[model samples]
Target: MTNGSPSESAISPGKPGQSTAVHVRDVTMDFGNGALAVSNASFELETGKFLTILGPSGSGKTTLLRMIAGFETPTSGEITVNGKPVDSAPPHRRSIGMVFQKLALFPHMTAAENIAFPLKMRRFNPKTIPGRVDEFLDLVKLGGYGNRRINELSGGQQQRVAIARALVFKPELLLLDEPLAALDVKLREEMQLEFRRIQHELGVTTINVTHDQREALVVSDDIIVMDGGRIQQHAKPVDLYRAPDNAFVAGFLGVASFINGHAVPGGLASGENFLSGTHAGDFADGTAVRGAVRAEQIRIAAEGGQLTACDTRLTGTVRDTIFEGERQLYVVATEEIPGITFRIYHHDPESFGLFEIGTRVMIGWNARDMKIFESRAS
Candidate 1:
């Protein structure tokens, strides 16, 4: 939105005392091309909470974010900010702050000037703008570097400036559209923590959209997983990891290995081995089903004995061993499950090359670690 002709209010346009910061109700976006970009999406963000919408490309995460940002109007639903509908409100007219992948700082403007731009555009008290700029500069930890031009600053510093600019006016809701996508791995991880720090410090309700699962897990109080224009699951990070509602969510959120099988008397039957595990719904005998077990939950045992009181056991040949600094990954192929290969993590920092390739090892996991879900194919 153009900075000109926007609202002049410094505080959030949203009414106060409402627990929800943003409310999206049965929102859908159809671009008139016979395909819906977002389908019947609904969620609520509490005051001062951090949420991330995570999915791969074409999953409609960005489209969902754009709808909330007032850039695109939903075809079938209403969006409310602090309990008021903002479907017809212009972007700038809403009390929301946004940071995108591109920093979008004016090259000719200094950092301090960049922070003050929003204040000037919103027509804040001219005398108070300078102090406000300094306050935000310090808030983002760029206190003394405000005089540097955009080109003179480092990439991370430029990011800090962008954040300062967005938060200088203290908009109640913050939208981050993959703001850290351009940084290197180390810097991106650092900024993820920085984002959490700043959000906790200010208690500004935030919603971020990204394809990065680690970022979503690291910085969000809650997460919504989307696929094929639909929301698959929405839950807190730990619960989303520990207990996924469906197979797609289980495979997407963690390193889970899959074994296709059919439902039996009490569990699932894959090849010659009987599997036992947790499941959300009832599965009739002879129904098509698939079992999932996380990498961390599987452990390597001795050839004749089990590891740590596991209920389900299997003997497999170690096919590949991968070292990843803090942990070792052992890939096992068991004859009992002909087509399925299991990846197990050994987080013992000192256990480098603990198992050699071409070695026979017994791997086992507790019954609870293996989750059974109805086959998506069925």
Candidate 2:
């Protein structure tokens, strides 16, 4: 695992009723026998903002979320919710609403009953429970679903019930742990939008953990990418995708292609070809480096086609082609790099000719679209 610095320090605790929604400072978790799950993680979340912790399995995203939810205590460091330390507070006293990967709805309860469970458990006014249930049903667009049993609803409806249940009691913070992971792709996308809508409507400060990149991008105001027990990069969705801090974040976030080369004055060089790119890291001349480019950023054309606008150009043979519905992916074997193949995406397949296997073509991209980083396995 690569070591990474914490993205940001916790925001200073604010005056009464003005604290950051969540603040985790230098939090580390280690099991016995050197099983370290998370290391030196720190970030601040503002009120009414949505943050997604994105990473692959075993990346410690879930463990971090569990710590915030008070399910597990951090081995070191401090966690604060609304300016109060919560390391020793039990889950029920933390005023947090959670939606787990599994719906966890009571099988025998009706949808309305499910939503009302939290309120009843919290000892809300008995006379107000029915009206509150109706209001929450409307919030999740599940009005009139109170009479239907859990088994009678569709999967998406069941999901709505779970969300409504979590929010009905009006917790100060919401934590979602891969709630849409089990849904079908289409439903999951739809629910991603629904989650955004509900969050905005209620103005809830939320933290969600997911391995799905698309879900994180679609739903988050900011994203924190975790890997190998460390915080990698924390930024808005576009910045995280376009300006990754390292090779791991770039590879994890999108369909990235890398070319190994040594650092030149402003870019990288592979054999006789000099590739122009942009970078933010300190790389001395002659240092081993790699150029990273997204597949969609490169444009491909037949030989002799005009590419005067591109900063870097290369000639290659189309080694493979994949026809997705909206775009076509081409794998090009370039002469400049002996064993490496460049993956390029053509979005307007209907407008451009599809270069079949073995067809000679030219590929080009602007230097700004490619980023140079220290060579390492992503």
* Every candidate's CA RMSD: 4.2, 7.0
> TM-score of model 2 relative to the true fold?
0.93
**Can you write out model 1's per-residue Cα lDDT over 244-336, one digit (the tens) per residue?**
888888898889999888888656888778987776478788778878899999988657754658877889899998988788898999868
TM-score to native of every candidate shown: 0.92, 0.93
lDDT per residue for candidate 2 within 128-243, as digits (tens), equals 78887887788788888899999999999999999988887778788999999999999999999999998877777899999999999999999999998899999999999989
lDDT of 2 at 230: 95
Q: Which stretches of candidate 2 lie over 4 Å from their true place?
A: 1-19, 33-35, 376-378
Q: Tell me the number of clashing residue pairs for each predicted model.
A: 0, 0
Considering only N, C-alpha and C atoms within 3 Å, which residue pairs clash in candidate 1? none
lDDT for model 2, please: 0.87
